[model samples]
Target chain A: MKITVSEKNGKEINVWFPTWLILNRFGARITWQVLKKHEVHITSRQLRRLVRAMKKCKKTHPGWRLVEVSEHDGGRVVIDI
Target chain B: METIGKRISRLRREAGYTQDTLADVLGITPQAISKWECDITCPDISLLPALAKALGVTTDELLSGKSESEPAVKIVPKDERRDIGDMMLKIVVDSNDGDKVRVNIPMALVQVALEMGMELPQVSNKDCLRGIDLGEIVNLVKAGAVGNLVEVESSDGDVVRIFVE
Candidate 1:
C-alpha cells in the first residue's frame, strides 16, 4: 500500500508499506487464537480460506491508485493498493 | 445458426465426455451420440433434459449452442476486481470547526476490530460514527460493492464519509 498527501504549499508526505500480509499456515494459527480471544469461534478450515483469500487478493493485484480526492483548498490525498 | 447436434458435440467435448461416455451417462447408445455430434439427427425431446444433464449444460445450451443468459459462473477479469482482504476502509471527517480528519485502515483489521467491538471515539464522539456498524459495511463488501459505504451530513455541518476501496 502507498499513500501520498500533498498540500498547496508543495510539501508532500509519502508512505509505502510492502508485504504486510503474512497469512500463511502459521499465521492462521495465530489468527485463530486472536479471533478466539475475542469470542469469535471460527474453524481452522475457515481460517485457511481467509489466508488463501488474502494471498489471492494481494498477489493478483498490485499498485492500484484506489482513492484520490482533492479538497477545495488544493490539498490532495491519494491512496494506492 | 448452430444446430443442436453441433451444440451437443461442443458441450460434450468441452465437458471431456466422449460419445461412449456421454451415451453411458444418458443410458443411450454411442451410435446415437455419434449421430448427434455428426448432425445426422437430434435427440428426442423426451431425452433433451437427460442429454443436457449428461453434457453438464442446460437444455437451452444444448439446443442453442450458447450459454444461458444468466450463467452459473461468469469470468471476471483480474483487473476488474479487488478481493476483500486487499481493500481498505477509509474514514473521512470534516468538522464544522474546519478540522479535516482522514484515517485509512485495512479491511482485514476492520474485521478483527468488528469482532472485538472496537470504538473510534477520536474520530467522532458523535452518534453518527458510533452508531454505524462495521459488520454491515463488510457484508456490503462481500456482496461485491465498493465506494462510499456511509456518508452523513449533520445539521451542524459536520461531514463524515466512510468508504471502502
Candidate 2:
C-alpha cells in the first residue's frame, strides 16, 4: 500500500508499505470484525476470498490508484493499492 | 425456515440454476447449498444479497417466502478478532506554529509499556499526545478498529491525527 498526505502548508509526505501488512491472517481477521461493526457482513472465508482477490489484483494491476481526496483546507491524500 | 428453504430451492430451479451453479456464483460449496435447501443450516445473513440475486428473488422473499421490492444485504455473524505483533502506530501532529511532528512506534512496544506502567518517551513527551490514553487506543485497535484512530484539535489550532495501518 502507498499513502500520500499533503498538509495545508504544502508539505507532502509519502509512505509505501508491503501488502502483506494487511493481507496477513491477523489483519484480515481484524478487518472482518471491524466491518461487522458497520453492519457489513463478511465471513472469515469470504474475507479470505477478498484477500485473495486483492492479491491477484496487485499482481495484475500495478500502481493502481485506489483512492484520492482533497480537504477544503487544501490538504490532499491519495492511496495506491 | 423450512418454507424459506423451499422458496430458495424453488426460486433457484426457476432461475435455471443447479445447486453447483448457484454455489459458484456466491462462492460457496454445493454442500452448503444442499444443507440450506434441506433446512440443515441457514445462509449467513451477509450472503443473503448475493444469494437472492443468484436466485432472482428479493431478500424479503428469501427469508419469509414473501416478495418485496428488492434485496437487502445486512447482518453477519460476530466472531473472534485477533491481531499480530510488531504492527506500527503512526502519529502525525500539525502544530499551529507550523511544526509537524511524525512519530511511528511498534504496537508491541505500546502493549508492553501499558502493561508495565511505563511512559513512552516517543509520544508521552509530546504536548499534543498528552492527556490521551494510549492504552485505550491499543484496546480499540485490538478490537479490530483501524484507520484514523484519533484526531485532536487544540485551541491554538494544532491538529493531531493517529492512524493504525
Candidate of highest lDDT: 1
What is the alpha-carbon lDDT of model 2 when measured against the actual structure?
Answer: 0.70
Off by over 4 Å in 2: A1-81, B1-82, B119-124
Question: Against the correct fold, how does model 1 do in TM-score?
Answer: 0.38
Best by DockQ: 1
| Model 1, position B136: C-alpha lDDT score | 83
lDDT of each: 0.72, 0.70
Can you tell me the DockQ of model 1?
0.04
- B1-165: candidate 2 lDDT, tens digit per residue: 257678888999999999999999999999999998888898999999999888877788778875564222222223533342434576776777666555555565456545544343334245656667878878777776665777878788978787765
Tens-digit lDDT track of model 2 for A1-81:
999999999999999998899888998889878866745565677677666656665665566555555565778787777
Candidate 2 colliding pairs: none
Q: Where is the poorest 10-residue window by lDDT in model 1 chain B?
A: B69-78
Task: Tell me what TM-score chain A of model 2 achieves.
Answer: 0.91
lDDT of 1 by residue, A23-68 (tens): 5677689888887785567777767766665555555445544456
